[model samples]
Target: MSETVSPPDRAHPGLLGQALALRAAWLGMDRAPAAIAFAASVKGIVLLYVAVFLVFCATRPGPGSMLIVALGLAGCAAMPARRTLVIGLTTLLFIMLRPTRSEDLSDFLRRELDLVGSIDQRILIAGAGIAFLAFGMAALRLQSTFRETAPGRHPVLTMMLVFFAILSVALSGLLPVEFAAEVWLFLAALASGFWCIAYALADQKVKQTTDPLPRAAFFRPFWEGPTLPIGKGAGFLAKFEAKDDTALAVTRLKGLKLIVWGALLAGLDAAARSLLHTEAGLPVLTDAMAAAARGTPLPAALSWASLVVHYLLDILHLAAWGHVVVALIRVAGYGIPRNTVRPLAARSLAEFWNRYYFYFKELLVDFFFYPAFLRWFKKYPRLRVAFATFCAACVGNWLFHFMGRIDILAVNGVLPGLRAFESYLFYCVVLAAGLILSQLRKRRPKPEDGFLRYDVLPRLHVGLFFCLLTIFNEPIDAFTIGERFAFLFSLFGA
Candidate 1:
């Protein structure tokens, strides 16, 4: 049977309905007296809190103590070109700021600038130029070869091109040994940003609904953090961009609310850390290990409590930071979602993974999980699912972290760095196994199961599992696998 297709004008009538609803809401916000009163009261309260927090918490008071102002200025400077120029500048910044023993930025730059002006820099620049040309040429060929068929395009070609660039930079010998590592680090930072370019290439090749972002909007958001792309692609980001005056106003308001909420969480994290570490005298993992080695071990309960506090504080810190970053982006007219959510309430390993470090999970799932899932294990559904889960949860997770910390690889060499990652390696393996089991055992809840059995118990179980694994999650160099295991055992009177 031939299905009747709707006309393009009526194809997405729902979008029009949504637009009308939004206009109505905006008009209502202005007209509603009760809403106006409530908004005014909330705004006044938030302003008061902001003032108090700024006075006590935000300002540190002293020379060179206005770090917050410096950060605000940096963000402001980048805000103008939140699309591409910022990425270029930031990448250049990373390249120039090679690791140095020099005590000050001025001294370090003076030393590094010589290397920057050397043949190594030229080689690096030349390599980038050639790579860009190659990508452009390849893209053109793909377009011609595929004959406008989008299905033939793949992200792997772009990824392989990036890998080649990294390898060329690292082994080109056009750079000093120390400088080559830094260059590799810079490339790694820019690697994930390639998603934008890849998506753009695919769109151009296939002629998708997603119009490729102009070249200017391509690279900016990728290197904003440690290789974990904050907002995915320009297409995903388009949904959040403020379309009109009302949207801009709403987005800015949302940004303001986030700033306030982030401030509260930050305050809470600070208080909790002070109470746990300063008042209670409980140490972090590294310090605890040192204490144990000295035979001055803390009580098991106190130690466990400190670890729990550390984990919770870490989550709070990420949430606060994510909220602040999302707020800033929204205020600048691009709406990005929060990176962290209510992870503590997650009912399973899979749920926790999704809630915590959402963008990282998204990156792995998009790039690794789906690809592996579709390509392999078609004959065995369960194995395919589990294997694909492992690819994302373990393999992709490790690669992201390892490359993100390329400085360690530079200083210690590849072997030593891998050695130092033993605990992390174990953690990833165990985590993947747990997540796979959790996925396989997942079931729908019955009303008769009650809240305790269905909700509270499951949440507690997942929380306990993650909390236990937190010991091995730290950089293994900071605390060895044996030390982490011993500490874990000590928590249970071993």
Candidate 2:
């Protein structure tokens, strides 16, 4: 079961790496401060939780929040502190929120499951308490357990543990067992990570010869690694020549990388989906779409396809129109010696997009089918650009149209959404025409002595054209820069 990874051929890996690296570096600095701050942050978060409960009590005199808070403090405090009053308090909060009927499981759980919601939650909290006890009794247990593991400890293993711990902490809200155990475990892990980072950053010497705790904390290994030092020969991009010296290449790298990664991830997702549908009794996205079309209440898992499609359509439409505004604004302010080289370089309908309206393209290419497209482009440069451009528009248009069409079809019982191909071509043509006109309108080399065209012509031409576009196009109308104000020009159109 080997998974394929298809990153773009022209993709640069520097940007994402840089963002993460920067975060890690900052975290690595002043470990002790981070640890203490993390502990303090947890205490504050707890108090905040308590305050929220207190507020709830003030509003409706509910015991649920109070119970939760007391239970939490008990976990943090001790066995003697874990009084029946706290449990009673939690039960009361659940009772307040509980419905009159005892039939609904959710409701029943809220009310009846007050003491320990589930066996799993109880185990989680009880286990944590045991661990805390062990830590207190045998302070060296952690060091011993970590060292004496039969499987043997390694940086990779340490990292895996750290990753799982971090994930637990990060996804605290989504935890299935909303019990005292999970909350405490999450808080403790947060403290651990925060303190570990703080300790690393503190002005303290390394007492032990070496702590291979990275076997337990993932990112720490990368931090401890000698290779990633700052002012070192470009930690990630050291091998890449483009990153070595070129700025333009570096700029395109992120966009290209995203194009590459997005495509691979999408493919992987598709394949995983196929496998799931085949092996398990799982329905695919298409099934979800069909259900949505039929006005059937789709299962939550199935709804993801429609949601993704909706978001994709909305975002791309916005990006495309936003780029158009950028073009118009650039032209509107052309009198100030601005350049139109980007627009001019786009020779045809397709190139116009690669030159203008580029973010989505970058997004698509970097993330969607970068590897496939890069290879396809390299092999057939002429057809590559044209096909890629057309496909990008078509898919984007199709998704957008499908979303709108689905809305109409589901709600109004309409047949056939907008033709993806027609709108795709229309988008291409309009953008191409705009670019061509811009190129054709590129100013003749101004003589030093000639009347400065910078003053009036562009103001009349570019500004008027922009205003007109805003009035006519629905997309443009959505991005109006300024009010007409009875023929007055607006400061910002979009």
| Native-referenced Cα lDDT, model 1 | 0.60
Error of 1 at 55 (Å): 12
What is the overall TM-score of model 2 with all chains considered together?
0.23
| Residue 66 local lDDT, model 1 | 29
Clashes (N, CA, C under 3 Å) per candidate:
1, 32
Best by lDDT: 1
Off by over 4 Å in 2: 1-361, 367-372, 375-380, 414-416, 419-425, 432-494
Clashing pairs in 1: 150-206
Q: How do the residues 292-320 of candidate 1 rate in per-residue lDDT, one tens digit apiece?
A: 54556678877777778778888898887
- Global CA lDDT of candidate 2, please? 0.33
Evaluate all candidate structures by whole-model CA lDDT and list the values in order. 0.60, 0.33
